[model samples]
Target chain A: MSEFDEGTAVVRRPDEAVDSSVFDTELDKGWQIGGGINGGLLLSLAARSIGEHFAAARGLHPYPVSVSGYYVSASRPGPAELRVETVRAARSHSTGQASLLQADDEGRTLERLRVLAHFGDLARADEDVRTSATPPKLPPVEQCVGTEHAPPEFLASANMLERIDLRLDPAYVGWALGKPSGEGRIQGWFRLADGREPDPLSLLFALDALPPVTFDLGLFGWTPTVELTAHIRALPAPGWLRITHSTRNLAGGYLEEDCEIWDSRDRLVAQSRQLAVVPR
Target chain B: MSEFDEGTAVVRRPDEAVDSSVFDTELDKGWQIGGGINGGLLLSLAARSIGEHFAAARGLHPYPVSVSGYYVSASRPGPAELRVETVRAARSHSTGQASLLQADDEGRTLERLRVLAHFGDLARADEDVRTSATPPKLPPVEQCVGTEHAPPEFLASANMLERIDLRLDPAYVGWALGKPSGEGRIQGWFRLADGREPDPLSLLFALDALPPVTFDLGLFGWTPTVELTAHIRALPAPGWLRITHSTRNLAGGYLEEDCEIWDSRDRLVAQSRQLAVVPR
Candidate 1:
């Protein structure tokens, strides 16, 4: 099994004592970045817990169509628990909220991530009627710079890079050479090293897998995400996913970064927007 | 008081047994569109509830910085109840989840909207260091088409227009003459008719106050928003705000529309993205 699959595995906990369901999972170190767990990985764990709750309840909605997560605190590698409560279940869709919690250094259970998700079956989606969205032009994957070869300082904090293959557009990687592009944009091709196929749940991880767009703007420090919302528009076809992340506005110590992902079939599979603090 | 202020007024409900805080508010007819309460108004109510929750608890974070709301069902103009639960209260920011519930025809309490909001003190924000964002080019307010005089069919359902002044860019309002530019974009100037200025709270309503961007694509039918996430980057200046909504991808019976709000000082105040079903 891929490391991602193993890392995000969750087991339902016996929960007759509480109104909501609880699940336990172990956060692994393979997904750590900047001495903290990847935000996407934490989000995926919350998504998995929600999916498990719906499955055990035999709910008709199985796929996460839209989910918004707020990062309450930094997560570390350890045993964590997720508590999910169903908000509502309608004929067409279901909504739930999940909280990923872990024990801090003081042995206090801290809520690290909180997610509100809407689930539905994507197989029932209508066929595409029109699309003006076109894929961004990029050189062949071979010509692009592999993120595994990123600057040594970046690689020091980006331990998650070892689990996947991310090739960035050459034009946007000038920062790696000590000459930043200052474009506030990053485009890349993403795929798992073990050839694991991307699913709706895993797409949450991929949506935020790339380096921060601020890196290209000459601000090479960490830009922690404050809140992120992802929409799964369609299921993906098996292959490399083309991704682009860009920020248009930076003000009052906050910036909004937008991302779009297209599958191998050239279909828009996912879209996400995140609010992050501008690195000081 | 402005109709908007009157419409979204919320009073704390006395609840001694419940675990969450509940507030009662009336959904006024002045904000109805297409026989449904405006999504922005519903979101504003949720934000207000969160703010009230923080204030009542004496939390330091008084302003909502990031909020994501999922529209569960269409809401009608009437009495609605908002129940807010504190997710996590941190030193820098506090998080809360709220559900806006209303009684259905069968007297069942149906969840209409669910929101997760992050609150912080905006006055403590850092000064703007750099920004690549620019306001969209627009004609003077007088030269633009006032949305109150929109196409009769659109006006029929857009009663909210009477409470706010929305002047659309003439180049994008060709749909009113049966000649849409097919550009899938809408830009406008927005402000309350009473000349009331926008604050961080009211900016939530203004984020989604304009007509659907799909209208410029000649899709005149209603486009129901499935989920919307808005980030309050800064407080707006006391003047007309420039707003633009546009869609880049439309597929699988869904589309993602993005909106940017710029204050009169040309500072980006708010940004939002919504997932909506395409009109059939």
Candidate 2:
């Protein structure tokens, strides 16, 4: 019996001392409330930092800023590193490239990312643009929730999506979900199950998880995001991350997915685009 | 002249051809380089098909799979009208969506995409992969290709980038014929003087272009794509489409690009990605 935050996990055991092998040492620390860091966590961390960099560079603070796009390339884990290089710095908008490196013990590059961001230009809101219908809203996290399933694969997922406050908003809200395979288009909401603030890379890794929810049988637990790109519209306050993903229209077994992230304010925070092939 | 194969445009005088405003009116009737009716031309037609419906349905495709990303909600022009609907035709691998609309005065969906694709059950290329410094071995279409004042507010972009064939093999070969203005990252062996195929979009179009190269800029004109997710190993053929693009490292301005498409033989088709700023 422990207390939990709205979006964070509540660790109930730490001293239980579970037997661990290769994955036990660093992970078992906060068994009762661990959500510290993992692959997705790093991505989210990276995203946050990159977003902040843009917000400041573009003077887009106070007002929300969205993530324009993200490309997460897969690699074996190693030393965590982030290299941010600017693309353009303008009076109104600013763009840059960020790469995160997770190197092996030998200092070799493993996985990394190159993120693109546009900041300070809220001017588009004034332009004659049509915002996509708000994805059907979801039951507040307070309504209902699910417990965590710590499968070996989940652990292997690098904690990117370790703790998610997920729900399929409403009926007909999505094409893919906890039902028959959909036409690939999906819609839903997500948040840190533990409510812990994850980094940008961490968020990206977690996002890599969402698009494959329908494709992965949840059996072997191997969902590889060959390539992932995200576009951000806003950086919502940490809590829940809303999203919609689809792949059903997959051609050549090859498919692509576009996802958007939203905050409670209804402001679009980020968009994710991905290309993956489900192995038959 | 050398024999033009499929996908090659059949040149015709402006008056000798149908009105250009009417799409599919044959801007240039070229050899049939498509499967029945699928090819780059058809895909472009299908892409500009239904801006609203597809945006509404939010469907994704994985076959003949489009490499378009970066979408800016724009007003439909007076070309024709279209309505894209994602339909699950009775097919496998090729299971995909279609739209119905008019490419002419009759508001009809003259174009639709049928996919014949299934996820490759084949194992991913071995984890131990490698990339070729061998580079794409293709001569640039000319000393300078691409267009200079193509039209519209494409901005700073000179000739269609038909200037040079960028090389990444053996060593990175880069040659930009003009000095463009924009505080960001730019790369690739762009050509000029508009002497190559008239592409529809580049990977980084702010105009609704998708990926493998999900980019940020408004995809306004024709831009080729080259490069891909990366390599644990070199490709089957680093043909002419093989090109390399990076932020080239940004400082005060930006640093980003998107995907660079390459020919099966590794010739540089187009390179995309993006860049941003860091401020001093």
Among all candidates shown, the one with the greatest lDDT? 1
lDDT of 1 by residue, B1-280 (tens): 8777787789987765333688999898889988699999888889989888877776579888999999988999889999998887778888888999999889999889989999988988888647788899999999998875456887888878888988999999888888888888999899998888998878899888898988888888889898999999887789999999999877778888888899999988888999998888
Q: Model 1 - which docking category?
A: medium
Model 2, C-alpha of B35: deviation from truth (Å): 36
**Model 1 error, position B265 (Å):** 0.9
Task: Show where candidate 2 strays beyond 4 Å.
Answer: A1-42, A48-78, A105-111, A121-129, A137-162, A168-179, A185-187, A194-206, A209-211, A216-221, A235-241, B1-280
Clashes of 2: 167
Question: What is the Å distance of residue A14 in model 1 from its true position?
Answer: 4.5
If scored against the real structure, what TM-score would every candidate get? Answer: 0.96, 0.42
Interface RMSD of 1: 1.3
